[model samples]
Target: MIGVSVIGAGFWARQMHLPALAQLPGVRITSVVATSPESAQRAAAPYDEAQALTDIAEAAADPDTHVLDIVAPPDVHLPAVEIAAAHGKHAICIKPLARDLDEADRMLEAVDEAGTRLFYAENVPFIPALQEARQLVDAGDIGTVFRVKACEGIGEPHSPWFFDPDRSGGGAILDMAVHSLEFCRFFAKAPITAVYAEAGTFVHHDRTTAEDTAVLTLRFANGVIGQCEDSWSLQGAMDSRFEVFGTEGRILVDNLHRQPLQVVNARAGWSYPMPIAGLVADGHLAMLGHFLDCLRSGAPSLSDGHVGRDVLAVVDAAYRSVASGRREEIKETTR
Candidate 1:
């Protein structure tokens, strides 16, 4: 069996990762790690063999832990991944890989030196509708794609850390926009050259220091104009949409609005907190399946560390553009 250490006893771990783990046969949850034993134990309660621990190093160093499944916030990702790599363990780090470029670089370096895989847990590509959309765009059904737009909006995140810049690294841009930004890259399939962003804490000033609303413009090498809007002031409703404009035809996707069949398995701990939770759940499972396949076959992952770093670079560039009040070049980010 492939032993797994899920290193966060939070919402994502309980609601998202655990149910997915239940469906997979060969993997076992060896540990549930958290900042406190109570949280860890609460999260690990369903799995009989899972050990509750506060020390991440102990979990990573375990002989049975082949992978450290990190579901923590952006702040803990690097340290958790670093510890995993130090013990020669593969890791699955969730979206928005780092706060900045240097941290992303160190993550890549550690994994490279350890000769282990760092699977970036970016699930947007695994969305069923988006996958079909990508296929059509690639097959020339949309002719030469030129303009891409994507947006994801939510009222507020369940956790307070998302509002805490010290924990989350950035606001709506880094949190929700990363999804849309990665989707933009997914459609463009080219290097982003420059990015301009307008972001501020428009509504949630009392809640967070980070921006609650933002828009990002991306200039791709292939001349694709990619724009992303992410927001947290949508009241209680959630909205997600993607549009691709092309010479011959156009494709538009609204993933959250409707679905033919939806499920809410309370016993399974899979509840529909967000309107798109069903789709997101499927994406999470599909993404995990792909990573497990990579682990077993010793193959490359579609959303690997390199891809994560690339996305982070764009995010970093967006923040820079906000600071400079001009389009920032991704290549100039090193300076």
Candidate 2:
């Protein structure tokens, strides 16, 4: 079994990742590390075999830990990564890899220097509805794809750290737009050239100076334009959807709304809701399972730390665009 130590004990760690990790075969939940012993134990309570540790250094030094699964807050990601590299352990880091590009580069560099893999644990690509849309586009169901759009909006996040600029990066755009950007990049199948964005603190002014809602226009190398929208101030249902348009047709995938499970295949001429597992659970399960399989097979994952860094480049530009009130150029990065 590939022994894994999880480096967080927060909501995502408990509700999403830990449960998914338990369900994966050939993976052992060796430890759960948190800022405190109590938090670690609480997060690991469901797993009988998981030991609780209060610090990443202690968990990284443990010989049984072959991999460090990092689901910590954005600010702590770099430290956990450095520790994992120091211990020569592979890692699985969640999305928005770092608060910024410079930090993300360090995270990527450390793992690369150690010759250890850091799989970017982004579940958006593995979402069942989005995957179905991509397959149809690839199979020529949507011929010569040209335009794409992805949006995710929900009421304020559960944690307060999310609204803090220093800890969680740039609020809704960074936290939620990262998801839309991933799927948009997936469908475009090309490098993003430029980003035009607009965002402001429309709500939660009392909570943060950060933007609660944002929109991005992504220009892809393949001549396709993609749109990404994110909001923490959304007052309605948690609306998330993906739209892929091509010369021949369009494919629409909707998740978390009145017709949440609907996948409208323009080529097949169908718009029907199909029952599946819950969105959050299914996404984490597929992504973590894919990473576990890659661990044993020695295969490169679809979203490596470099890919996360690349996405951050867009995010970096988007924030700049928001500030400058002009379209920002995306600096080329090593992806």
Candidate 3:
């Protein structure tokens, strides 16, 4: 069994990772590190035999901890990973790995030098709906995927740092685009050749320096085209929709509003509390389970740091395209 040190007690940490990790076999959270000692303690209250602390160094240095699961913000990711590397612990980090390519390179270098098993925590491709869609595509139900359009638009995030460019990278594009960018690559099985993007702060203009909305056109090396849309201004429920067009057929998976179990009431109005989409479908458990399996059997996660870097590379080009007002060629990375 791999003992896990969970870094960050934020929303994703509490709502997703912790709950999922709690149920997975062969993995146990030994420690919890958060923004504050109190927060860490609060986060650890549900888990038996788990210690709480404010310092990642302490968590990583713990002999009982074999894996460092980082659910921290974008800015803190590399530093946490560095601690994990220094301690020679296996790591699973959330996506948009670093602020930029340089930071990502440094983190990759550190982990490589330490020989740490680093896995990028990207759960989009692991979602049941998306997995089924991929299976169909792989089986030639969609003969040759020529075009893909993926969109994720939700209201403002729960955290304040999500609005800051320096802390969270770019706004909607950086926060939500990573999902579509990575999943598009997964579906197409091709590297992005170029990207053209347009973004603006129509909403939340006064609230943040980053763009609140963005649309990117991605050209794959294998002649497939991808359209990615991201926004933080959508009203009401979130939109997690994808449309893939192939030579023989088409597939659409509206993951956001796919409510397998719905409820209606005169007092409370119609609602779907337990939506069968995204992490609610146990994607996080599947991801963590896969990582633990990798740790035990010497396999590799489907979404590793290299895959995360490549997706970031596309986002990097998209930001450049936003500035240049033209299609930007994706820079080749050695990793």
Candidate 4:
């Protein structure tokens, strides 16, 4: 059995990761670390065998733990990885990998030096609909890929930290666009050359200093262009969609308001929360299972440190472009 310790017990950790881990075979939750002892206890309450601690070091030092799953904020990512490295444990970190490219590199160096595997828990590409889209592109149904469009619009985030630029690194552009951007690179199979972006806090100006909505256009080295739109102002349910246009045909995955099944309640009007690709998606289960499988078989992750770092580079360039009011060249980083 692969015993794992979770570093953070926040929303994603409490709702998604733990539930997914519970359903997986031959894996157990050994420890849970939270900001406070009470919160940790609350997080670990579902698992009677699990221990709750306030410090990551306590979980990292656990002899029964084989892997560390980090779902903390952007800033603490590298430090969590360092603690795992010190104890010779494999790590799975949720994106955005780090606050910036430099910290990402340092985290990569730490994992490599410790001879431990690192997985970036990005679920966009693993989505069944997106995976089908990828297969179509691979089978040449799309002919020569040229342009892609991905968008995500949602109401305010559940956590307050998402609004703080310092804690989240940025606002919608950083938290929401990262998924679409990574999947764009995955399909393009090319490095991003430059990024041009425009962002503003038009909707929630008083709530956050960071931009609540933004759009980014990416130019890939292979001549592929990608457009991404992210927002925190949309009302009601979440809306996310992707479209890939190629020389021959086009592929579209719409999960926003157009789901297979829609339920409308007398009190709640129109609700489409059943088949979302984002929250509570089946992709989360697949992602966690893949991580455990890789841990057991000693295989490399599809979303490794290098891929995570490259995604951050695009984010870095996007923010720079937002400041300079001009397209910024991305300094590509490779594994």
Candidate 5:
């Protein structure tokens, strides 16, 4: 069994990663690290066998821990990943890999130098509806995909830290838009060439540096066009939707939290309540299992450090496009 240690016991970690890890096979939660010892203890209570410690170094140094699952805040991702790499442990870190592409590159370099594998835990493409859409595209049901549109809207107001450009990495674009961008990249199976974006702080104007909403247009290398919208302040509740148009047909995925796929075509018109299997089994659990499989078999990671860096480059280009009021070219890197 692969021994696992979770870094950070925050809301996402508790609600998603911890519960999922509890059900995964061939994996054991050996320890947990948090900012506070009490919080770590509380987080580890469900897994009685796991130790709770405030010191990250202790968890990183443990000989029993074969993998480190980092679900910490964006800023702390690099440090934790570096530590895990230094100890020759495989790591799975939540996206966006780092605040910027430079940091992501450094993290990737460290992991490569240490001869350890790294996985970027992006759950969007792994979601049921999105996965179904990808399958359809691969099956030629959508024919030649030419255009795509996606949006992620969250109603809740973000904390002050989210408003700080440095801490949050330029507001909605990196915070929310990356999900849709990555989805488009995965489905289209093409590298993004350039981006043109517009951003504004329409809702939360009081914040010194933060955009409450953003819209981006992407040009893929294979002649595909894509658009993405992201917002922290929306009229209604959270909404995640995506649509892909191709020569033969089209696919649409809406209400990702509840429904999976909704499809419409020239022949069949529209189909409601399309059935699709959720990717990754139990979400975070599936990610953990995949990481363990990679560790044991020396298999290549699905979302490796190279892929993580590419996503960050897209994010960085989007922000640059927003600032310059012109299209920015995305730099390609080895994956």
Candidate 6:
């Protein structure tokens, strides 16, 4: 069994990671680390077998801990990842990866230099509906994907940390649009070459630097065009949806947090109600299980640090395009 230690026992940590780890086999929660003793205590309350600590170094140095799960805030991801790599432990880090591409590259470099495995905890692809959509596209149910569109927004916004650009990276682009970007990448099966974006603070006016809404258009390497609409402030309820158009047909998935896959074809019109089995109670568990499996089998991680770095590159380019009022090319990194 692989022993895991979790850092930053916050809402996501408690509600997602801890519970998911509890349900998985061949994994043990060896330690729970938080910014403070009280935070760690509160975060660890649900896991009776885990110990709460405030120092990541202490947790990483623990002999029993084979993996380090960093579910901390975006700002702390780099430091936590570095500490984990320093201690020679495999890591699973929640996304946007880092505040910027430079930090993301550094984190990946550290892990590579340590000869440690790194898994990026990106759940959007692992979601059953999205998975099915990918399968359909790959099967040529939609022949020659040419265009893609996706959106993710919440009617209600929470957490002051999310509103701060310095803390959360950017606004909707980094926070919500990343999911849509991943979806487009998954369905298109091509690298994004360029992006043009626009952003504004439609709501949450109190924040000065961060935006509340944004729209991005992407040019993929294979000549596919894609667009993503993301917002932290909208009319009603959380909404996430995607549609991919190809030469033969189209595939769409809507209300990703709650709904299933839907497909439409030129010959058949529409196929509704595609049955999907939920992957896991908590996505963190789904991702964690995969990480443990990789560690056990010496398999390569699906969402490796390089993938995280690539996503961060796209996000960075989007933000630059927003600022410069021109399309920006995504720069590929060797790391």
Provide backbone clash counts, one per model: 0, 0, 0, 0, 0, 0
lDDT of 1 by residue, 172-278 (tens): 88888889988888998888999999998877899888999999999999999999999987665567898999999999988765644434443432223464565
RMSD, every candidate, angstroms: 3.7, 5.6, 2.5, 2.4, 6.2, 6.4
Q: Sum up the clashes in candidate 4.
A: 0
- Per-residue lDDT tens digits for candidate 3, residues 185-262, read 888888999999999988798899898889999999999999999999875446788888999999998874566665
lDDT of 4 by residue, 259-295 (tens): 6666555566455656554444537888889889888
Clashing pairs in 2: none
The model with the greatest TM-score is 3
lDDT of 6 by residue, 66-107 (tens): 889998879988998899999998888888789999899889
Superior candidate under lDDT, 1 versus 6: 1
lDDT order, best first, reads 2, 1, 3, 4, 6, 5
> Model 1: which residue pairs collide?
none
What are the per-residue Cα lDDT tens digits for candidate 2 across 289-333? 888888889988888888899999999999999989999999889
Query: Predicted candidate 1: what Cα RMSD to the true structure?
Result: 3.7
Worst 10 residues of 5 by lDDT: 274-283
State the weakest 10-residue window (summed lDDT) of model 1: 262-271
lDDT of each: 0.86, 0.87, 0.86, 0.86, 0.80, 0.82
Pairs with backbone N, CA or C atoms under 3 Å apart (clashes), candidate 5: none
If scored against the real structure, what TM-score would every candidate get?
0.92, 0.93, 0.95, 0.93, 0.90, 0.90
Error of 4 at 206 (Å): 1.0
The list of candidate 5 runs beyond 4 A from truth reads: 157-160, 257-282
Error of 1 at 241 (Å): 1.1
